[model samples]
Structures are given as C-alpha cells and as structure tokens.
Target chain A: MATQIRELIGNHKILPVSMERVRDEDDLYELGMTSFASVQLMLALEEAFDIEFPERMLNRKTFASISAIDRSVSELVSGRA
Target chain B: MNVAVNPAALTTPALERMARVADEVAARYAADVDATGRFPEETFAALKRERLLGCWIPKEYGGEGLSLTEICGLVARLGQACGSSAMIYGMHQIKMSSLIQHSVGSPWHLDYMREAARDQLLLGSATTEGGIGGDLRNSICAVEVVGDRYRLTKQATCISYGRAADAILATCRRNPDAASSDQVMVVCRKGDYTLRETVDWDTMGMRGTRSEGFELVSEGDARQVFVQPFSEIAAQSMLAMAHIIWTATWYGIAADTVVKAQAFVKAEAKKKPGTVPPGALRLAEVSASLQQMKSLLVAGIARYEEALADESLMNTLSFIAELNTIKVSASQLGIAIAQQSLMILGLAGYRNAGPWTIARNYRDLLSAAIMINNDRILGNTSNLLLISKIDVSVA
Candidate 1:
C-alpha cells in the first residue's frame, strides 16, 4: 500500500521531489504540494485504491503526507468491507 | 444543480429605497468626487444617516442584521450613482464580513463590531503590500510582539480611502520569524495607527476611490490580531465576499449603462415619427449582453450560497475556480458592455458632461479586470481547473 501510494504520488507529480528522495512521512504541503496538486493527488488516489473519500476525510491533514494518505485509503478500503 | 434559496430576504422595496438614497445623494456628489479625485463624503454621510453602513452587522451586534445579498443590492444601487462610492462600500463590507466571521474567540473584535455598528464606522483594507503587488496570500511585514503588546509597520501598496476610513484591516506575518504565508489579520483602529502617504492615485477612473499608497505604522494589544489563520479567513470569507460584492457593483455599472442607452434610443426614436433609430438595434444587443451578465452573476451568487452551506466544499478547488471565473467573466463583460453603451449613445455618451454620459462608466469598468489583474486570476484558475472535475449542470 505504501509503495502504491508513493507510486500514485510520483505519477501525479503532486510533490516537487523525486520519489526516491522523498520519505513517506514527509509533509507534502511543506515540500511544495499546492492545494491544486493535492486535489489532483486525491483524484489519483481514489482511482488507484478504488475508494471514495467521505466529506470528513476530504481535508488537508488527510493528505498532508504519503503516510497520512496511506492511513486514510486503508481505513476507507477496509471500512467498505 | 441544486438551486438554493437565498439565505437572506433582501426585498425589492428595501433595495429601491436604498437606490433612491444612492441616486439622490451619491449622484449629487459623484461628478465632483470624480473631478477632484476625492472621497464621496456626501454619499457616505447620507449612508451614515440612514445607518446603512452598519446594516450588515448581526442584529445581536447592535446592527440591522441585513444579509449578504441585501448588502450586494445596496452596493449595486450605489454603483449606479457612483462607482467609487460603490467600490468603497463593497470594500468596507468585505472587511466587515471578515470581522463578523473571524471574531469567534476574540473579545476585542466582538466589542469593536458593536462599536462599529453603533457609530457606523467606515472600515477599509490594506491587503496589497509594496513588494507583493497583487499577491494577497503573502506578506513581508510581521507583527512584533513583546509581552501583551505588538507593533507592525507595512508599506501598504493601496488603501482605498485610507485617510478617511475609521479603521483598516491589515494582514501581516503571523510572527516575527513566521513564513511569508503564515499570516494574521490585525485591526488598526483610528487612533492606534498612523498612515504616511507614500504614493498618489491618479488613475483613469475610480478616481473617487482615492486609493493611494501609505506606510502604516501601528501598535495594539496582542488580542487585536485574529487567532484564526489569515489564509483560512481569506478563503472562507474575504475572497468570496470580495468577488461577489464587486461583481454585483460591476453588474450595476453595466446595468446602468444599458439603462442610459435605452433612454437615449427612446429619445432618438421620438425625434423620428414611426421609424426605429439605428442606435435602437445596438441598444437591443447591449441589453442582451447585459442579460448575460445578470444570469452569470445571479448563478454565481447561487453557487456561492450553496457552497457556504457546505463546510467541505468551502476550500475545494472547484468552488475557488468557479469564483475566479465569475470575476473574470463579469469584469470582461463589464468593460465590453459599457463600451457598447457608448457605441449606442455615440458622442453624447463619450462627452464628459451630459445626462447620457457614460465616460465615467467606461473608465470605471476598465478598473474591474485589473483590480486583482484578470491575467493573474486566470493563471491561478488554470491550475485549479486542471485537477477539478467539470460538473455539467445547467439547472
């Protein structure tokens, strides 16, 4: 899941850093992930993980970092089951 | 495509009465204000006498508790008589909206709102700085806090009616060492701050706005600063209100141009028995374009009201993109519409002195597109729209 999240992040060009240099716990916003890119990343994550983010989950904190996205996607994917 | 009812009931009678006041007082001084490039003191005095300046403050705050839509209506009427007065009123309301929405935990702000309401104090804004230009999200100046007191000095790029306003809401770095984006809004009351004129405002129009540069120096209690982040305050209230209210005012300028053209066309037709004047057809086309402005602005207001009801959608890229589009479209059309009105009325409209003169309208509408710079708005919106899903809903 972490690898796939990183893959999505890299593919979407959400952050300025290359995936190799980026850590899962790095704050994407601090690393120049703008609100526009974050939303684009959110769209990319939903398609890759096959999970829709609820209104409560649609916020800055939920997508603040790669690990945060991993946590949100995992919870949503499991909750659907 | 859920069409939401307007949250506030701004009736036609109230709007008409307010329009009468605008036409009677604002119109009386508008020419002189524009000629001398000064604030419309007479118009504001009338608005104060009517207690309309504080009409938007919540009734609990000793105000009439008029809704945003009502205030927009009032602003549109004011624009018909004087664009500068309308611009100033919309701006003050923008700052007022900020105060009302952000004063949740701040006792000083709440008390100040009551004071502003009771005294009908005129508020102004200083968002643009010397170095930043039109970029409002960043600020170079920081509030220096020592103990319970803080001091700030900023090269304010443009302050609308700076010398005449009762208070000015200025944005600054959250702390001395905070990042440029980490900012807070501080209320600088009349006696607390000193403004030194830094630049002159001799523009093509909106001359009555007297929007000049000033070096703002102020000291106040630390509580004078808002606890909420300036970014959040801007997104939630400031940007939305500014765009909507300004569009309404721009719409008024366009609408009034159409009215003048219609009158001119009617007079020309009367001069010829049973024959339509050539200008009448142009008037029809101009009125039709004015309808487009009306539809776009009304729908934008509906979308904004709907978004305001939904917390999740407040900061969404979709809503922000739509807001930017509304400004771009309204401003572009405002200039075009005023130009078309001039075309319909010809030399009479072009002249500086006439009942049908739209020279002021043309020059004022010209200020719309460049107020925040449409190119910059489009540049920002282009990025937002890239990730946003296009929802095709006509209803």
Candidate 2:
C-alpha cells in the first residue's frame, strides 16, 4: 500500500523532488505539493484504492504527508470491508 | 440543504435604494470619472451616506445582512452607470465574503466585521503582487513574525483606490521561509499600512478604478491573520465570489447596452409610423444573446448559493469548471453585446456626445475578457476537465 501510494504521488507529479529522495514524514506542502496537485493526488488515490473520501477529509491535513495519506486510504479501504 | 440565505431576499427594499443611488450619483459622474482617470469619489460618498458600504455584514453585526444575490443586483446597476464604481463595490464585497465565510474561530475578524458595519470601512485587495504573474495563489513576500506582531512588504500590482480605502486585505507567505504556495490573508487597517505608488493606472477604461500599483508596507497584530490556509480560502470563497460578483457587474454592462440598442430601434420605428425599422431584427438578435448571458449568470449564482453549506462542494472540479465558465462566457457576451449595440446605432453610438453614445461601454466591456484574462481561466478549466467528469444534468 505504501509503495502504491508513492507510485501514485510520483505519477501525479505532486512533488518537486523525486519520491526516492522524499521521506514519508516530510510535509508534502513544504516539499512543493500545491493545492492543485493535491486534488489530483486525491483522485488518483481514490481510483487506486477504490474508495471515496468523505467531504470532511478534503483538507490540508488529510494530504499533508505520505504517512498521513497512507493512513487516510487505509481507513477508507478498511471501512469498505 | 443550505438555504440560510433565502434567494427570495434578493429583491429587498435595500436593493431599490441602492439602484436609486446608482442612477442619481454614479451615472451622473460616469463620464468625468472616465475622462479624468480618477476614483468616483462622489458616487462612493453617496453610497457611504446611505450606509451601503458595509450593508452585507450580517444583521448580528448591525448591518442589513444583504445576500450575495442582492449585492449582485446592486453591482449590476452600478455597472450600468459606472464600471469603475461597480468594480470597487464588487471587489470590496468579494473581500467581505472571504472574511465572513472563512473566519475560522477568530473573534477578531467578527469584531472587525461589526466595526466595518458601524464605521463603514471600505476594504481594499492586494492579492496580485509584482511577481506571481497573475496567480493570486502564489506570494513571494512573507510575513515576518516578531513577538506578537507580524509585518510584510509586498509589491502589489494594483490596489483599487488603495490610498482611500479604510482597510486592505493582503495575502503573503505564511512565514519568511514558507514556500510561495503556503499563504495567509492578513487584514491591515488603514493606519497599519502605507501604499507608495510604484506604477500609474492610465488606461482606456475602468480608468475611474485607479487600480494603481504600490509598494505596500504593513504590520499588525498576528491575530489579524486568517486561520485557514489561503488555498482553502481560494477554493471555497474567493473563487466563487470573485467570479460570480465580477460577472454580475459585467452582465450589467452588457444589459445596459441592450437597453440602448432597443431605444435606438424604437426611435427609428416611431419616425416611420406603421413601418418597422431595419434595426428591429438586429435588436431581436442581440436580445437573445443577453438572455443567454443572463441564463449563464443565473446558473452560476444558483450553484454558488446551493454550495454554501458544503466547503467541499465549492472546491469540487465540477463547481470550479462551471464558475469559470460563467466568467469566460459573460466576458465575451459583454463585448459582443456592446459591438452589436454599436452596429445598431452606427456613428451615433461611436460618438461620445449623444445619449446613444456607447463608446465608454465598448471600451469598458473590452476590459472584461482581458481583466483576469479569459485565456487563463479557460486554461485552468481545461486542466480540471482532464481529471473529472463534465457532469451536466438539468434534473
């Protein structure tokens, strides 16, 4: 799941730096993930995990870091189980 | 689900009073304001006298609590009389909408709104800086925090009537080292900021706006900064409000020219007694364009009002595309309507002297497409389309 998340982030071009150089805990916004790119990343994750994020999850904290996104996707996918 | 503001309230007695001010004051000085390239002081003076400047602050804040729709009607009327004055009004309300909608547990902002209602403070916007290249989301200058105080220096590309405004809403990086995309909005009251003119606002139209550039220096309590990131503010309020409100003003500009064209056609028909003037068919054609433009605006307003309760809806791909569509369509329709009016009036419309003179309207409407640059809007819309479904259903 973590590898898939990183792949999606790279595919969406969310980071100015390569995923290999980015730490999972690094702040995505600080690493240059714009609000524009954040939306794209969210959609990509939704499609990849086959889960829809509730309206409340559409915020800065939900997509703040790779770990944060991983946890959000895990909750959504497990909730569907 | 969000009907906190009933759309029916758009036709209040306050709207009528505002229209009267537009007709009597704004219309009277429209020509001189344009020619001299200055702010429409007398028009705003009349608006201030009537306490219309802060009329949108909620009734709890000692205001009339006018809805965005009502403000739209008033703005369109002002657009008919003077584009510059209408722009100033529209821009201020956009800032108000931003503050009102995105307060985020901050009591200072609420107190400020109440103060605005009682004291009638005119708000100014310093969003576009010297460097962002027209993107309001990016800011190079950062606010430096020293103890409980914060200060920022920005090369604002334009602050419409900055010198005369009571307070200015400025955006900058969250801190000295924050990235360009990370920003916060800070409200600087008049005494907290100084605007030194760095560029002149000599232009063909909207000259009365005095949208001059300045080196803005401002400092205030850190509590003045909005809690929400500038991105959320843009996604939720500023985008929808700015597009809808600005388009309302442009729609009024287009609608006024249609009225002039109808009057021109009627005068010719009266001269010929039983015969219809050749311009009658042309009038019929242009009126259809105006209806289409109005439909676009109505849909945009309805969508925005419906999304009032859901911040996520306001940030959706579909809502973003639709609002941007209203702006692009209305900007084009405004200029086309003016051109068709000139066609109906010939030299009478071209001249600046007669009652049928549409030269000012033509020049002002020309700024519509290029103001925010329709190309940029359409380009942004194009990106959204790539990632989302274009779900258009009348049901």
Best by TM-score: 2
User: Per-residue lDDT tens digits of candidate 2, residues B1-395?
Assistant: 01123233334476766777789999999999999999898887777766777788888887888788888888888888888899898998999888778875899998898888777778989999996857888899888889989898999998888987888999899998777878889998888988899999999888888999999999899889888888778878898898898888888888888899899999999899999998898899999999998888788888998888765566667788889889999999888989888889889999986799988888888888887789988888876665556665893
- Pairs clashing in candidate 2? none
lDDT of candidate model 1 versus the reference: 0.85
List DockQ, one per candidate, in order. Answer: 0.24, 0.28
Error of 1 at B268 (Å): 1.2
lDDT of 1 by residue, B1-395 (tens): 11222223233344765676687989888889999999998788767766777788998998877777788888988899999999998899999999888999989999999998878899999999998998888789999989999899999999999988999999998887766767899998888899999999999999999999999999988888998888789888888888888998898878888999999999988999799999988988988899998777787778777877986677776678788888999999999999899898899999998898988988999999998999999988876555566657676
Give the CAPRI rating of model 1.
Answer: acceptable
